[model samples]
Target: MAVPAPSAPAATASFTNAGPAGFWQRAAAWSLDAALVAPFAGWLAWPWIAAPAQAWLDQVRALLQHTGQTMGAAIIDGASLPRLAITLLHDPALHQATAAIRSATWAMVWPALLACALLGAIYHVAGECSPWQASPGKRLLGLHAADRRGRRLGTGRALARYSAGALSWATLNLGHLMATAAPEHLALHDRCSDTRVRAARTGLPRWARAWLVLLAIAGLVASAWLAQAAGTVMQAALERALFWPG
Candidate 1:
């Protein structure tokens, strides 16, 4: 009786309170984030990305002029630029010239990639560590990220999460698919960082959610495609610049 009386207050059991986001929610959030930040990344990398391509185009133009290829020389002379481009695209000489350009440009890709990676890391880490506890995209979608104990991530943890997320995107996105297979819907990056994405209570209807997700995905894809197309056009323009000073 005395021992029992002396016993301290009973310890309270604790349980994990994380709300773990599902695949669709995470995908929607990522799509939104990419839409918002990818352009900035491309802009940051533009100078580095274009330099080698420009140089290669210039070299190709000079060679084409020297070799006396009618279409290539005309392309450089600003004579019916679009028509010449179409002709060159079918020209075997054009293929060889651009092949050299393509090879040279490959090495230059690293700078653009590095710039984009850095921007993306900062964007994700900053958003996750903020008081909002999510990127703007995730917040808009009523989702948040947290640790196993339902705590907001610290900056260090956020950085680690972003770094691991890069791996999740690599390897055919098998790491991301792990979320679908996990009991708690934890992705490989989340597991590696001991974090999870949680959905907050929201009043939006189902249709709105679907539309939002779709819009975000479409925007991200369109932005990426446009960036790539712009780069291609820039390289072609550099070739034309050799003939037309403008």
Candidate 2:
């Protein structure tokens, strides 16, 4: 049988024409992506495996503490600040938190890796748009993908745009959260991906229809800041919880 060509994604944008994606739009897109991938990944691997993961991290933290004591001892013996700082790098107590972080992080490796791979596949294969033409989340928001000028981004531009997320996400996903707020509505990833997201002109509710577009933009900035803060909080919490291990 002849292979059927791929079709445009079936869109789920209930509020198309609601205007440009607000922070909520981007947020919804990501939520959709999580919805798409989380069920299988979490159901199959998370709950049952969490205990082992936590236990392993705990042991790693203890080892880090032991190592910290050894380093502290060495520093006292040498009476050297310079050596202490350098040697303290190996300090076990100091690293208990770090090791716990490392261990906890390891636990998420599988799921995060799978999510990233799946996200990439979903994005790259989308329509004739560039790899960055439309993120999987954007498509689900009933948003259309285009460059600022409303042109379809070609292959080369798309790859760069897609690659930008590696950077955008580096700052705790501020890259993505910041995009919806840009006057141009271009995220760091969007510039790299050769794509922009606009509200689809369909079935727009009146309230959303007349809402000031800039409000969405401001919301995006606020939300991105909040999201970044949340990441910092989680990291600190992980450090404290895992501190005893070292």
In order, the Cα lDDT scores of the candidates are 0.71, 0.58
lDDT of 2 by residue, 117-212 (tens): 555645553542633345565564556556656565665655566566678878887887776574656666776666676766433344433343
- What lDDT would candidate 2 get against the real structure? 0.58
lDDT of 1 by residue, 1-246 (tens): 445532211210111333566777777677778777878877887887687778766755554553344544565656796776677668776677767767767756777778778988888888888766788878877777878876778899999998998788886899998877645888889889998887764234485478776787978999999767655655565555555544
TM-score of each: 0.59, 0.49
Model 2: ten consecutive residues of lowest lDDT: 8-17
Q: Which candidate number would show the highest lDDT if scored against the true structure?
A: 1
